[model samples]
Target: MKRKEYAWAYLFISAPIVGFLLFAFIPLSYSVYVSFTEYSGYQAPVFTGTNNYAKLALHDELFWKTLFNTFYSALSIPIGMVVALGIAMSLNQKVRGIRFFRTMFFLPTISSVIALTLLWKWIFNDSYGLLNYLLELIGIQGPAWLSSETWAMPAMIIQGVWAGLGINMVLYLAALQGVPKSFHEAAEIDGASGWQRFVKITIPCISPTTLYILITSTITALQDFPRFQIMTEGGPNYSTTTIVYYLFQNAFRYMSMGYASAMAWALGLLILAITLLNFWLSKRWVHYE
Candidate 1:
């Protein structure tokens, strides 16, 4: 009977297993093979050993530039976290219409990404855009945000933070709710100030959630591409190009599939290293109760 049950369970799950092998595992394996060869999409792959990797390491200045842009854009992760946590704390108050306010805050997360990006693109337009118009009213002229090398990355970061705020706020709100009232009450009785209770009790209790957000946000930031594609198309001077955007360009535009594959693998290794580092560092501060 147990054997029959196990067979039935496997039978039910086999569809996904087959799909993974067909769609994900096969492509991943082929990409690894392709990374060692020179291939355009139309031609058979020509084996090139480590030449692609060597060129990336030694000759490609754009590789380093895009990598730098990727990490620089990740600055939004910590800024978003702090802003989202503050928003979550504000929404946690017990008041009428709080649920409605929460919904408003979270609406952007469920909205269409393409639509949001398009909207932001217009908002950052150099002339007659709402942002620059507001700046003009304050006696300050906004730069040509999406066109200026100095400001393009900052524009991307601002949009990224705004678009990501809803999801992060929701996650932090859930974590905030899970913290026990008794802990705060006890701390209050001990004459802990409001800020002390928050810093000492609330933050520790939510450390696991913080770690989760940090890891996910870092990965998302590193793989960012859509905004770069739509907002700047890698930019006036390649200023906003991220690693993933550069990879996309090589694979599709330049027809350097082998080099793109190598970049993909390098990015994967980077993500893995960072995630492992986050886990290693979490041992010191991520308290679970």
Candidate 2:
């Protein structure tokens, strides 16, 4: 529009644009360069072409394991989504004490992640763990949750789901609340059952939020590190090591900055590809109102 309006708009947007270029694009470009070299942070990066990726792909068994574990742990996303949606539905009712229950459900999400992770670690301890103790009282045996290769990833997934349930539940609750009651009432007049109303009306109406949560949850799962690191240390046979954890070890613990940068680039590209795939697939399912 007007020149003065343009000037004011530019002034309002300038800081964030400058910040993003300086802090985001510049570092991203630098990391792309670093990924092609062999810099250990103490010395200049020596150009190495695709050796790092080749090494990671063909030679690093732990890399494959970590990659697998990362995807495997992400299995919690769908499970968490179902549970969250169920809880959100229940909370969407106009029942008494609903606000209090909502606050309690959301507390875990806003609480200290470190403290919660430490508590979960203790709860997974083989003998004295609250979980195993309860299982014992029920005449069921519990495996070494963090120590066993078979169970460690599941343990991490459980912690991830428990800690993350509140946020996703809140998201679904918001989406549910946005749905017009008239739609359900109209469907009821047509003799549509509760399940039919939910499936044909509610789901399509909230598909946008569902798609948003699914993509974000998947990306977050790919890069999740804190809970795994604090609770399992990538654990008893590297069974819990994820791609991000592997990248961290190579970057800081082993001091392989360039290699870690390569891993970072790979992870970024993977996330981009998956996100693109989701957006493309969304056209088939996600309906916006």
lDDT of each: 0.96, 0.93
lDDT of 1 by residue, 41-84 (tens): 89999999999999899999999999999999999999999999
- Which whole-number lDDT from 0 to 100 does residue 2 have in model 2? 100
> Candidate 2 lDDT, tens digit per residue, 15-96?
9999999999999999999988999899999999999989888998888899999999999999999999999999999999
Clashing pairs in 2: none
Give the count of colliding residue pairs in each prediction. Answer: 0, 0
Give per-model TM-scores.
0.97, 0.94
